[model samples]
Target: MTRPLRLDALAYGGDYNPDQWPEEVWHEDVRLMREAGVNLVSLPVFSWPQLEVAPGVYDWAWLDRVIEVLWAGGIRIDLATATATPPAWLVRSHPEMLPSDSDGRRLEFGSRQAYCPSSPVWRANVARMARAMADRYGEHPAVVLWHVSNEYGDHVARCWCPESAAHFRRWLEDRYGDLDGLNEAWGVNVWGQRYTAWEQIEPPRRATGPVNPTQLLDFERFSSDALLELFRIEVDVLREVTPDLPVTTNFMSLLRDLDYWRFAEIEDLVTDDAYPDPADPRAHVPAALNYGLMRSLKGGRPWLLLEQAASAVSWRDVNVPKAPGRMRIDSLQAVAHGSDGAMFFQWRQARYGQEKFHSAMLGHRGEQSRTFRETAAFGRELQRLAPVKGTRVRSRVALVVDWDSWWGSSATESLPSQRLGWLAQARAWHAALHALGHAVDTVRATGPFHGYDLVVVPNLYIADAAQAAALEAFVASGGSVVVGPFSGVVDATEKVHPGGAPGPLRGLLGIEVDEPWPVPDGAAELVELDGERFDAPVWSEWIEASGEASVVARYATGVLAGRPAVTRRAHGAGVAWYVSAALAEGGLVAVMRRALADAGLPARTRIDPDVEAVTRADDETDYTFVLNHGAREVAVDVPEGAEDLLGGDATTGRLVLAPLGVAVLATPRAAEPPFVTLSETTD
Candidate 1:
């Protein structure tokens, strides 16, 4: 579990672009902030060009006044260093800092994140700017957090150029120590492509023949590390100047290019920017999954929902307003998952700009409209539930998050098929646990796994012997595991493991796979679990038990009909299960529920499908948040003696929730805290 924000309760409000308006309008903005219970506002996100008008020079006059005004109005400020967008002067002077795409075309500097992450010139300039910002505002009373570069690697995730090639070579040398090791790992001898010198290697850029799998994987890793290095330079400066203020950069959730597991470790707090389209039917599922992963990034600590659309967003082809109360419900959902703060992208809608159509707490009409009223109401609700602050969600389930597997499967050409889902397959497994009402953490498959009773590794395509050993030991020590198909098929170097597939942990699974059969481009098949038939249209493998593994499910039809589709083996004190195909949504849910039962983990709360139930606990109470995302009313059977926080009354049974409605049930705890942690207080 996690804890509170800057003050006694949840922090609110978001990006405030006071520079866009005149100084006379500043007082009115502050007045509106106070009325809406705005507590925190991030400042100067895209202000690099404005901050540095000339080379090696900065103008901080407007930012200083804005911070002072917000502080006088009793609002905390999340100070951004304003390096997300580089100044045109800097880019124009050093054109080498501009990033090139995979096609070798240099992208122009009219947009944000224009500087190449691997460019040394860009890094040095960004460092000076970060230091200047930190020195000027380090001691400000209103600033409680330092916001690093906004959403690293969002637009320019990869840069392919001669400079990038040099950086990639250095990164590889650091990892493998020598050219011989790189040759061996990449298996360059296979295509008469052995490297004799350090300069012989280049990034996987614009190739006619298939690029080396390991080369492609290494390039992805290098790009992620390059972004990390850029962010760390700013983080180091902030720690030196504002040592006590928490530092964080908002992560765009599930960004495939940047490695979040690596980025999360270097920051003081983890925060994410989520803008799920209200019109998509599967929007909330991904949002929920990302929230769980974001919370887990800091060890299930209290993270913040740094940005969300109060109504509609600008970038999408279609911008749809959030149905009434949907914003409130989703905001609270972030809290239920483990957010200590709820914020949006903009406090006020911009009059003219790229994101002018983006919705904000105070739209163009100001605070006299529905958006402002809803924002104010949500603020008041956060104030009422202040007691729930500083609490965390507890869970015994963990889902494996492996970046190497992600790159190995998607960035390379060795995938069984182009349609073989990478991260989607992984998130599908999480969706199953979520559907069953169990809290789950997404953690690294190669890292230390602890305090988790059940670990689910979905599509972990790349696993070394050491990783396999760790999983074996975990299962041997009374921890249940559910392994997905196509896992443990290769090593970290993108080389297929010797012997059959699932090389290292094959014995733990007690089964051997013959070959994987991908569903035809336009076909689907069925598998039978117990007595129920389920469609599986992804990939299936032929499996035969080696020792003690028993078949759990089998393909009902096909040339290899009646073959084992799923298997389970009883290890020393725990059980290891495996799913050998991409099952339908319901099939995945059924398998996961059975796996949870095998691990003795029960649902936190049983409710309707569209209603989400999550519990968070503090020193005294277990706060259950039930939110109905459906369009119709749903009845929830209330537990005895539970008091409804919204109604301020004790409820006995049968509470009906209208569409987009929410209810908080507080139940007293008599035992010790649910899950033990490193600290009792977030302070």
Candidate 2:
């Protein structure tokens, strides 16, 4: 897991496709890039077919010229292996390379990423092309990082073809060791279906009846592993050719198909492609949540914001343009969270293709446009803030992000409510913490939680015995825990545990839920806490205190009215809070405040509610970012003697931030011990 050479200035740029335009446009593109202060650009992301003329021959003349031009222009290259899209001739020759949908429908080559993940020929071609690219451009002075296959599992994640079925069988063999083991894990006896031989197993396709839940869970896991293996193949070739080269793949964090935790162990850094919908009011929190999750992959190390929409994207049905100053705030927002680099999907807007309408730094109208002006200003500001590099975002609260739970919950229709999205619940808690001015980290559920003041297990829809044990130990060690609705209801295999709901965690939580009362879509019930009533929506559970727990909130109106809607327990000198239903922002913030207080943590800052402040620190300086995402100006309280790194000036008193404004302040950093350090004794 090597990273590229440390950048003197924050890297800024996006994917650059020079081959699409005439040779004359290349010169102007470079000049424009220089004007916008773009120091890094990803090249040839979709140029696989352009490089390979037929089968084995590669015409690298065009690519070599592109590299030399960008290098001469003083722009670093995030060089792509260009194995994203294959040549039509190869697919026509070997149609078995095409992936199939769950319904056994073959995906054609008209779109990108249509190849089967299990096809050996596809793997061979991708690796061959990767090696050729690495051998040719690995030594290029401008090349800084190697971007592996563009966004794996974007379109063709799971396939039901014969080749894929064979691969699935092999993966099952490796996982289960024997048919009896597979039967036991899958609980095949449920439907009088048990596999006696390897040949009897098949991919979960569009079957005549419902597929087994355990079978589907394993299939999803196997599919993710297949894609990971495919990526490993290309990365192996790239590393073999250039051992020191840092390699990365852009991850779409919201996509549930790929298991990014396992992928993070292989990819050099947790580089992700993030596109926040302008229409969603709560979009920024999820964006920050994803960024925090990405940064968490490297143990609080800074990560790359690989791709974001400059103004608008082409995929959405009603793509809205980002208002003036929005781009600058969002770009700086990335840096404030933990990104060493900020990049967009495209540097210049495409003239043709499905994504031609996608917004870019230099739009179709060129440098005179508003987008270009903002891009230039942001780049110059990033250049002035080089001291902020190498700093990491520190969080006192960690939200367990379990991909297994995500896949199992979403894929199964039998779950309480389909609206229970994994990230949605996690984002709810993160949003609550952000409102309270507490920085949060979204780490994998399996990661160690040694130094967090609070560990929020949002809808532990699925859990394991070991995971439950760890949480119990964390609570016993004086660490506060927040267990969201329906937590610990299912085990690791997506199976309901034998005990009552919230299973093994009943002891730590001091509550037992025999059944869940799922509120239908668009219906809500009132939760009353301390004479304040708030609408609790989505889900609620029938709870009874089995231990030393007290009712914090009760359902005011519903079938479970007067029952416990939220509970708190004093457990082993620590506290465990259970939110039985999804609450609106106001209620969640109140609950968060109570949790923080119970954990002996300080209250949130005294800043304007509209402005978000996140502080990242190195050994010597604290870099605080104040961002205004509201529609009106807001007053912010700045720390005394802080320097305005963005404005190149400093001032005390109330700092006013206009709508969509941003400010970066750097002050002498103080030594901060873990907000919650581990000890044998409880606090």
lDDT value for model 1: 0.83
Query: By lDDT, who's the top model here?
Result: 1
Q: Write the per-residue lDDT of candidate 1 for residues 1-683, one digit (tens) a residue.
A: 11124665688998988888889999999999898889999988889778888986768888888888888999998889998888888889999999998888999988788988889998998889889998999888888888998998889888987788899999999999998999999999877889999898888887888888988999999999989999999988888877777889999988888889989888978899998889975677778778878988877778989999889899988899988798898898888888887999899899998889999999878877678889988888788777677787766788888888888889966667777777888778877887777667787875467878889998778888778788888889898899998888888888888876777879789988788888887777788997998888878888887669999999998866999999999998889999998987879888987888888876433423566777788767888787778897766665666787877878665667788888888888635222211112222
Off by over 4 Å in 2: 605-609, 671-683
Worst 10 residues of 1 by lDDT: 673-682
What are the per-residue Cα lDDT tens digits for candidate 2 across 1-683?
A: 55655457788999998988998889899998998899999989888888988888778998888888888999999889888878898999999999988888888889899799999999998888898998888988898899998888888888899999999999999998998888888888887888889998889877767788888888999999999999999888988888887889999865789988888888787788988887765567677777887888778878888898889999998999888877777788788889997899899899999999999998888988778888888887788768877789867788888878888887766667787777788888888887777667876655588878788888787877788788888888898999898788777666788885787788788888878888898899888888998887787788887558999999999798999988998877678988988887778888888898888776553423456777888887788888888887666656666788877778564576778877787877765422211112221
Kindly report which residue stretches of model 1 are placed more than 4 angstroms away from their true locations once superposed. 1-5, 603-608, 670-683
Query: Candidate 1: deviation at residue 544, Å?
Result: 1.5
- In model 1, which residue pairs have backbone atoms overlapping below 3 Å? 1-392, 2-392, 3-390
Clashes of each: 3, 0
In model 1, the Cα lDDT at residue 541 comes to 86
| Per-model TM values vs. the true structure | 0.96, 0.95
Model 1, position 658, has a per-residue lDDT of 83
